[model samples]
Target: MSSMKDAREATFIGRRTDGTRIRRPLSPHLQVYDMVQITSGLSVLNRATGIAWTVGSAFLVWWLMAAASGPQALAKAQWFFSSFLGILVLAGMTAVAWFHTFAGIRHLMWDAGHGFDLPSTWKTGKAVMVATGVATVLTWLIALISW
Candidate 1:
């Protein structure tokens, strides 16, 4: 005896007519859509810059440990850093550390309720970015001259 069950009964298309609420509106309305000084467009970018700094810190720590192990290890690390890809990472890390540190101070000010105003925050953010850029260039320039 071949028993054939109803295959058509096994299906869910977003609703059961018996008595079940389907999709409800998302709670916590997105009523606040305006950007402010504390968490604005540019501030978000600073946060991402900080994340890069963290990654760079990890790379630096590993390189230091590798260098401390032996001369061969140090040579390998030196060769890697001197390579095109590693140099790119180093450059990015320099920028990231500068940007992240600069941004963190801004965040600290905000936490202290200091730079809450719009114009002041804007000016401060710009200053931080410029300073970061200058510092990064100066560091690379010094390193190049020394090398």
Candidate 2:
């Protein structure tokens, strides 16, 4: 029994406080703990927008398949996408995707030793948001007239 206990403890080398292993803190970390309201809001917004875009890509795929399938299929898809609300949702998703993409590029730049300063980080973040809107609007308008 003592040998069994030693073997188990040896494999579990992490430090624990009160009978449980302590978890190391996450970085640029999760917002659920010891974080301010504004930071947490951004954190949640980032994640929610991510999920929305992921699911929303399915809509784009659906539209593409509809187009490939022929007029009747395309027509049905067009009817839905052409609706005001659906168009708005699509536009929103476009914006979110663009923002995520640009932000990812910004992170990549940081990993390569660029955009590490406060000014650059803020600039890149703001640019991600602004550029996404501009680019998404351009895309939505182009798509709207494409049938």
Best by TM-score: 1
Model 1 spans with C-alpha error above 4 angstroms = 1-39
Off by over 4 Å in 2: 1-46, 141-147
Residue 46 accuracy (lDDT) in model 1: 78
Question: How many residue pairs clash (N, CA or C atoms closer than 3 angstroms) in each of the candidate models, in the order given?
Answer: 0, 0
Residue pairs with backbone atoms closer than 3 Å in model 1 (clashes): none
lDDT of 1 by residue, 50-80 (tens): 6777777877887899878988987888888
Q: Can you write out model 2's per-residue Cα lDDT over 10-50, one digit (the tens) per residue?
A: 55445666776543433455544655443344445567778
Every model: Cα RMSD to truth: 9.5, 6.0
* TM-score result, candidate 1: 0.71
Q: Please list the C-alpha lDDT of all candidates, in the order they appear.
A: 0.77, 0.73
